[model samples]
Target: MEKEGLQRSVEFFKHHNINIKTLVTDRHVQIKKWVRENMEDTTHAFDVWHVAKGMKKKLFALSKEKDCSDVSPWIKSMVNHMYWTAASSANLNEDLILAKWQSISNHIINIHDGHSTLFPSCQHDDLEGRERHKKWLKPGSKVYEKLQDIVNSRQMKKDIPMLSSGQQTSELEGFHSVVNHFAPKMIGFSFHGMLSR
Candidate 1:
């Protein structure tokens, strides 16, 4: 189905009393526009990792113009911070972002589209002694961290069995074997032809 169709489905689901608090999706312009227009009440979050990856790619491309290896590592670290800031309920304070921005020689800050709502509560004004912004911890910080830890641990455990085995098998080899056995050939194709049929 098309974007509009998917959005209609989402609206239909909501109308039917489906409990969808937030919609996590990639940074598609159409989807963003649709959500902004139709689903104002529902929280929308762009995939943090996808955003970071895009930033990294752009940074790498820009690095070609400016001869600097050090900047690449810094860009990577900043991208990682974006992911962590998004994933963690920990607020990404404006001061913290400004600090990182100031540290970089290039104007990487300008590239930010400002679509992400998942940011630190503390604004630029909050840094001043005058404004009294509440310093309450984010609601789901601990839970988010715990969930990430669990996923990482599970992935590590899954990899352990693969690490123990010395014999390595390529997926390409398996694919080729299946294709050769299944495809009908002109010569000596008795069992293979039957299998294909």
Candidate 2:
């Protein structure tokens, strides 16, 4: 149904002679492939919020795994880092964006330097006493290993570069909320009925 909506939207835009230069949507695999094949001229980007939501779910699950409980305390900060990376990344430089995203692994261990040549060092005031109190992950420990895997996962490496840098779907989601208030998903309506609603 989502793909159908995208197809209809594209057709409508094409009918009106408006070329879409960039498109942003959640990381829907089918839609991604469709855009790749059908809208080759368009730059399709994944919504950062959606990607971050998915990442948080994984982090939450990992937080429960034995030897991974240390991650529980940092989930919110990590997600915020993703949002910051997506929004603050300059130009469309994928490498720089990725370098920033991957820097968190070091940051978690309180080693905020030498992440990548592109980013080099974390941009932060020197921590006065914070590092001394927290239980930072040891490099070879299970939690750190799992965190490194999560941060450098193949999917993250690919999607990190493709995150939408401008214009989020939050407004669209707000519109959907209004629509759902009128036409709740649990109750089905006919095509014309849905339109009227």
Top candidate on lDDT is: 2
Instruction: Count clashes in each candidate, considering only residues at least 3 apart in sequence or on different chains.
Output: 2, 0
TM-score of each: 0.44, 0.93
List per-prediction Cα lDDT, in the order shown.
0.45, 0.90
Best by TM-score: 2
> What clash pairs does model 1 have?
91-120, 92-120
lDDT of 2 by residue, 1-197 (tens): 99999999999999999999999999999999999999989999889899999999999989999988988878888988998898897465888899999999998888988888899998877766744566677889998898889999999999999998887888999999999999999999999999999
**Model 1 over residues 113-161: C-alpha lDDT tens digits?**
3423442232233233421231222224543233223223443233211
Tell me the lDDT of model 2 at 118: 91
lDDT of 2 at 139: 88
